[model samples]
Target chain A: MNEILTQSVFFGMFLTLACFEIGLWVKKKAKIAIANPLLVAVILIVAVLTLFHIDYENYKKGADYIQYFLTPATVSLAVPLYRQLSYLKKYPLAIIGGIAAGVLTAMGSIFLLSMAFGLNHEQYVTLLPKSITTAIGMGISDKMGGMAAITVIAISVTGITGTILAEAVCKLFGIREPVAKGLAIGTSAHALGTSKAMEIGEVEGAMSSLSIVVAGIMTVMSVPLFATLIQ
Target chain B: MKFLRQIAIIMGISFLAELLEALIPLPIAASMYGLVLMLLGLVTKLIPLEKVEGAADFLIEIMPLLFVPPTVSVIANLEALKSILVPLLVICISTTILIMAVTGRTAQSLMRIGRSGGEKQESRTVDCGKNKMKNKLATGEEEKTDE
Candidate 1:
């Protein structure tokens, strides 16, 4: 079974899709934030590989095919941003300022914490892009010589944290305005947070999706500047 | 055929962005360039929304699934990550909450300031009234849906 699976070039791709579908079903049934499809899929894939004693490299061989779409998908984020352009026009300062502040806070906090904890430069850079979408974050981390896998893990954790805490944080901060609520979630958590934002309201959903693009662009531009801090 | 064309356009832009990344001395990622280029194209009407909408939506839909492979690699590197796991968790959770608070407050205040400043103008009342009605309707529906 192991040999057959390893030899099949499409095994990893098939497994990923199948696991993700199961993840979708679980999310649909569970109706909870913790049941994030990506999180579920990751855990399921990890379990399957370990239980079957499949080598990571062999799985990665087929998995790389799916990973190839990541870049184009990142580029495709423009569509949603474009659709939400009206929100940008209506509250340019609020949206832009909110995302800018959030992006800065994300990077600043990571830098300070990394320093306080005595993390090395590579680890610092890896954590730098933790708050943005995984697609763009992975690219930034890779370009900066950080461990992309660690960066991916950090991004996922940040996203899940954002999704779970979104309501509590909003209430705690008294963020009544839909725009503010959306911006806060997207800036802090990326697309995962946007999922929760969509559930909250339409305007919040629009704003959250908008923030993903702006925050992504802002992070991509600013990561280099921040990366110089720890080095 | 239409979907294939849409994908071709996206890939073509990605290819161009890759070239730009290699040519430019800046540390910008190729994906950034592609995103900027795509946004610009859409804004300028160089690429109509119809042309890329289908493929773009499809791509975004499956985006999370694409990250599974890279994330799964974490298992192989668990040993190295163990030492810093506590700190990593601390930073991710703390900063996420902190960012949400800071961003929410900043935007809320700024929006309030804008509203107050605009409210004094008599000419804006009509627009404000319409907006208020819209908000009321939206919140009303939201409350109903909540139950």
Candidate 2:
């Protein structure tokens, strides 16, 4: 069985999609933020691989095809951002400043905490881009000599946390405005938080998507500068 | 055929962005370059929204699935993560809440300021109009005011 599965060109891809579909179904039935399809799929896939004692490399063979779409997906983010450009025009300063504040806070907090925790430079850099999307964050992590896989994990955890706590945080902070709410989520949690923002309202959804793009670009530009602080 | 063409355009931009990443001295990602290029094309009307909207939306919709493989690979690195797990969790959760609070407040306050400023300007204009109407009534130009 192992030999057959390993030799088949489509096995890994099949497993990935199948698991993801199951995850989607679970999320639909659960109706909860914590039941994130991506999270579910990751756990399912990891369990299957471990139980079967299949090598990670063999699974990666077909899974790499799915990963290939990441670039196009990242590029496609521009569509929503463009669609939300009207909001930018309406509250240009507020929107820009909100996202800027979020980005700065994300980097600054990580830097200070990592220093306090005595994290090495590489570890610190890996967490620097945690608040941004995986596609961009992974790139920043890899370029800065941090572990990309760890960065991916950190990003996923951060996103899930954002999704779960978005509303409570807003209420606590008195962030009543829809645009500000969206910016807060997107800046802190990336696309995953944007999903929660979309659930909140249309304006929030638009602003959240806009924040993903703006915050991503800002993080990419500023990460190099922040990386120098710990090193 | 249309979907195929749209994907081709997106892939073309991505490829160009890859080339730009190599040629440029900056540390920007190819994906970032692609995003900016796509936005510029759209904003300039060089690329019609309909040209890429369908494919782009489809791609974005399935984005979560794309990250599955990369994330699952984390299992292989669990050893390295074990030691720092506590600190990592602390930072991720704490900073997430902190960022949300800071960003939400900054945007909310700035928006309030912008709104108040706009309201003040609007009231000033209204006051000027009222003063003009009073002057016209005093001059027996009430007919113009009514018109």
Candidate 3:
């Protein structure tokens, strides 16, 4: 069993697909936001690997095939951004300013909080770019000598948490405008939260898509500067 | 065949972005360059939105699945993570709320300020309408379902 798990590429591929499908099924059955497919898949994969004592490196060989698509997937995001260009032109300053503010706040708060939390340099660096998309965030994290894998995990957790709480947060903050809601979600949670924002309405989807682009660029540009400041 | 071409175009743009990333001194990711380049292409009519919509839809729809492996790799750093998990969780959740509240409120205020002078923005609205129509004409069939 160990040999098959370690040596067979099909083993990892099958496990990942099966776990994701099962996660989808569970999400359908439970109908709860917390039963997110990504979250479910992560939990199941971690549990199974731990129980079987299968090494992460072995699992990653096949999984990396899926990971390879992340760059293309991220690039393709520009299509939606392009489609939403009209909205971008109409409210350029508001979107740019909001994303810039969110980026700065996200970086500042994470840097200070991580330091206060007594996390080491590696962990602090990992947590800094947690709000941006994986492709960009991973780049910044890697360049700064942070753990890319840890940044990936933190990014997912931050995305899921934001998606789950976005509506409540908006309501609590009295944020009624669709544009504002969308910007907030995308700026803070990146793609996953933007997916949720899409479900809310058309204007929200457009605004969220715009925020994803602006916030991604802002975070990529500013995270290094913030890193140097905090270090 | 059309979808394949669309994918090729997106990948080609990504390659250009990779090249730009290597050339640029800043820490900008190749994906950001790809995104900005794609936006430039669309704005300049170099690549119409129709050419990429199908491939883009497929890619974005499955993006969450792509991150699963990385998320699971968290198991490898369990010891380090376990100690910092609480603080990390606190920081993530609080910062998310803070970002959302701050950005949302700021955008709302800015939009209000814009709207105060936005009545004279008739030309921009018409410009957007013309662009939307052009986009609709380009992706007429898609507009039936997606718009």
Candidate 4:
């Protein structure tokens, strides 16, 4: 058992899965908003790896093996997407128009704020894709000459920020429209924040989910235009 | 057998989509190019929504797995996190709060519109129809049905 468990690939998967399942249990028992399962597992896995002193490479060997699932999962997201098709079609024009406005406003806001704060060119590039899903954000960062490391950093930071503050921001602005709320966070922070949005209500989750796909499209469309415009 | 074929086709499209921008000599990554092709495919109805729906749903269900590498990296960069933990905490919390506010308010407002606008229209239509039907029905029979 030790032999199998200690193998980096096996250990990482076992640990990741085990921690994830345990996170579910924690969520059940604690009933605390802060005790989100993913956050819990993230903390647990990090602690386990640290405790064993196995170092991350060995741990990653296990994780990377499981990580292959991420791409397929991304592709498979079309399932709920299909389920939501009718809902999407119901107000296609409003959704498309609203999402475009929200995404552009999000980007514009961040860009303006960053510029005011003296963000350099590299940081600007990193911040540009902060609202996208992390994989895409990382991809954009690498392709556009922003540091991959910084992009990931910004993505995670954006996610956690979105998670904690989505409602506060909405209320502060009196933006009680579900579409607006969902679009705002999903546009600016992507999946991590979207997960938090799910907790507030089903409509928000659906809207935020919609935001993810639309915002991905918006970001992808805008980057090239920005590249040309900047050059 | 049918589902398997569907999965394969979807994956194939996804793969094709991934590699589409290789022809471009632009500074952007090929995958980014692929996304464009995918969008075009989607827009053009070349790849129907159902074709990718199964796969896309599967991807989101297991979304956390995708973050494994970075999570491991977190372990690797334990020292760095310790250094920036405060900022990280602040950022995550602030953003989350903001998002929650926006989403909740939007849902409430939409719910209001749906409730108010839809209720009045439905009531007007249904009430008028119901009154007409009631007027045609015998009063005794209507009272019995109501009871």
Candidate 5:
């Protein structure tokens, strides 16, 4: 048993996912907050690694196998997109147009402010794509010569911040409708924030989910343009 | 039928983007380039947003899972991140607040564009869609009064 726990890649993934399933059960019984099982798993794994004095590469020997699912899972996002076809077609211009303005303002403001505030080139580059999903943000950072590690940290913090305060900002600015609230959360913060927004209502969750893809595409389109603008 | 076609187009575009990424040696990762390429195809009507929304939504739904690999990578590269910890922290907080405030306000202003436009009455409805209108217009506004 000890050897199984110690050396088996399957054991590691099973243990992690078992914890995740337990998290699902926990959420069913109680109010699930930022202290989610997956998030806790992150903390737990980190702690276990430190306690055992195990190198991350050693853990990856197990964890990397699970990582293979990321791509197919990502490709799966298309399901919801199909369901919301009527609304998507109805507001084609409005949705895309709104996201365009949102993405440009997001990238442009962060870039200019970071540059003006005395950040070095690398920091400026790292900060450029913070609003984007972490995978893409890290990719942009690498391409533009920013630190990928810093970009990941920045992306996580951004999602966390958005999770914590988006509602406050929504209310502060008077975005009270479910769709608006959802869209704002989804567009600005991506998936993690959408989970929180789902707590608000179904409409918010639906709209928020829709916003993630629109915002993602919009952000991607703007990357090259923004990268050149900053340079 | 329509839904399936859109899914096909999006996946097709994604594959093409992936292929292109391999052909081009950009500093960006090929997956990201695939993403960018996919987005261009969608927005330009080359792929059509309607066609890809299904697959895109499914992918986005599972986004939290996507972070798992990276979070692991985070642990793997924990030592590397430590060297640049302070600046990374600064970038995260400041960038979050700044993006939230600026985008929120900009979106707010765009929502407010009805005051002088010919349809000011409809503009508020557009700005913060009445509950019924919201259901009708998926892109409509919210109660900005929540501010």
Candidate 6:
């Protein structure tokens, strides 16, 4: 029984699911934005792994399967975008412009800020795609010679912060339009932020969902372009 | 059986994207390919929304659950991250607010221009029925205030 529990594949799967369930329960009870399921799951999994002396490589045997699903999960983002197609068509210029501007600001600010702080090249590059989804962010990080691990951390942090503070930021800015609210959350924080967008309104939900894809595509294109131009 | 078929359709799209990723050698991730192809398929009416909606929704719903492992792997490099943790946190929080404000303001201003151009307001109602109802309720309350 103990051996089965330690087996890499089963261990990884069990820990992942168990941690996520616990995280969900905490979120349900706490009803707080900071009770992010992913953060909780990460903390629990890390603690368990450390206690058991299980290295990440061993844990990855089962976890990689979950990671692999990220591809199809990203593909599935199309459904919401499709559901709101007419909305997109009606205001293509505004939607496109807003996302383009958001993507540029996200990338440009990170680049300039990292430079001001004297972060080394790799750190700056790792942060370049931080606002995009992890699936695409990791890919861009790999291509740009950055650390995928760092990008993941940055992406997670950005997502959590965006999810937690989206409402207050919108209110502070007097951003009453649902479309703007959704785009802002999705652009900066990806799907985690979109989840917050859902709580606001359906218009915000749909717009935020659309922004995830648009911002991702724009960031994917722009990051490499900027990398080469700077070099 | 229906759910299985829906899952297959999504996986099939993902497989195709992987194939393209291998062939093209572009910097883009295969998932992006899948996402774009799925969008095109939906746009062209090649795939009905109902056919894949169930699987797609489930996948999105559990999306955070899937990232648990990758996020945990950060443990391996905590030593390296420790020195920069404070800086990273500050940058992330500040930039989130900056991105939110800029994007929201820009989108809102563009929308104002669009509305002023006399784009049919009624057409917007068809896009999201629920939001329209909520907007009516809020405006109704606002009208009472004016009286």
What's model 6's overall lDDT? Answer: 0.80
Give the whole-model CA lDDT for all candidates, comma-separated: 0.82, 0.82, 0.79, 0.57, 0.59, 0.80
Instruction: For candidate 2, write residues A68-180 as lDDT tens digits.
Output: 88777778877877887776886788889999999999888899999999999988988899898886788889999998889988998898789888998887765667788
Per-residue lDDT of model 5, residues A38-118, tens digit only? 565666677776787766666666666666544433334334433445555544444555556667767877767776666
Tens digits of per-residue lDDT for model 6, A33-65: 788888899999998888877777778888888
- Per-residue CA lDDT of model 5 for B43-144, tens digit only, reads 456765655666566655545544554565676666767665666566666655555544454444444342233234443233343444443342344443
Candidate 2: segments with Cα more than 4 A from true spot: A195-202, B119-147
Question: Which candidate, 1 or 6, has the higher lDDT?
Answer: 1
Runs in model 1 with CA error above 4 Å? A142-145, A195-206, A220-231, B119-147
- Which parts of model 4 are misplaced by more than 4 Å? A1-7, A89-93, A112-119, A160-181, A194-206, A221-231, B1-7, B21-58, B77-147
A27-97 in candidate 3: lDDT tens per residue? 89998878888889989998898898888878987888887777777777677676666777777778888
Instruction: Give the Å error, residue A76, model 2.
Output: 1.5
- Report the poorest 10 consecutive residues by lDDT, candidate 5 chain B: B115-124
Return the top candidate by TM-score.
6
Q: What is the TM-score of each candidate against the true structure?
A: 0.84, 0.86, 0.87, 0.69, 0.70, 0.88
Among residues 3 or more apart in sequence or in different chains, the pairs in candidate 6 whose N, CA or C atoms overlap within 3 Å are none
Docking quality of model 2: it rates as: acceptable
DockQ by candidate, in order:
0.41, 0.32, 0.34, 0.16, 0.26, 0.43
Candidate that beats the other on DockQ, 4 or 5, i.e. the better one: 5
lDDT of 1 at A65: 97
**Candidate 1: tens digits of C-alpha lDDT, residues A123-162:** 8998999998875787789899898888888888888799
- Report iRMS (Å) of candidate 6: 4.4
Ranking by TM-score: 6, 3, 2, 1, 5, 4
Lowest summed lDDT across 10 adjacent residues in model 2 chain A is found at: A170-179
Error of 5 at A156 (Å): 2.6
* lDDT, residue A78, model 6: 86
| Best candidate (score: lDDT) | 2
